[model samples]
Target: SFLSIAIGQETPYKAVVVTDGHQALETVTHVLVDLLLLDYTLPTMNGIELYDQLHAMPGLEATPAIIFTASLVKHQDVIEQRKIIGLGKPIELDELLSTIERLIA
Candidate 1:
């Protein structure tokens, strides 16, 4: 909720916060999600795994995503191959906003 509120205040985008990958998938399936900003420490599945599941859905493969993680190097290869940005945790708000702007532009 804090993340959603912060992004909403800073941008035109409406952020939806989900507890885990399951809720994330369910929410996006019903709602019109323009972009995905996922945290690596989700409850059930990790952010990268969730990304794969989300992309597997028909017509959502091209959606933009950014995965936040403290140990980004651990998943660098997959992140690079999938062309998804792996933004380290404790991300600067400005940097995050700029990245979102660039992706959604």
Candidate 2:
């Protein structure tokens, strides 16, 4: 949680954390998310797979998402293919806040 705490302090939006991609999928099924901040190395299914699935769902195809990773070398192609914003790990709080604000705006 550092990101959640930081986000809470910086914005009115609440951060809902899910342990893995499957949980994320389940959560999204029941909730309408304004933005998605996904880690690339998620358990069960990776971020890209989860993103693809989410995008397939009605009303979510255009949802803005930020995919973060500690290692991006292996995921660059998929990230570009998805046309989603990718952020390197140890993401700056300012940048994250700004990105979220922009996406949700």
lDDT of 2 by residue, 1-105 (tens): 888888888899988899998898889989889898999888798888899999898889999999998877677888988888888888978888988988897
Q: Which stretches in model 2 have alpha-carbon errors above 4 Å? A: none
Candidate 1 deviant stretches above 4 angstroms: none
Q: Pick the candidate with the highest lDDT.
A: 1
* Alpha-carbon TM-score of each model against the true structure: 0.95, 0.92
Tens-place lDDT digits, model 1, residues 15-94: 98889999998888789877889898899999889999999998789999999999899989989998998899788788
Q: Positional deviation of 82 in candidate 2, in angstroms?
A: 1.1
Candidate 1 least-lDDT 10 residues: 25-34
lDDT by candidate, in order shown: 0.89, 0.88
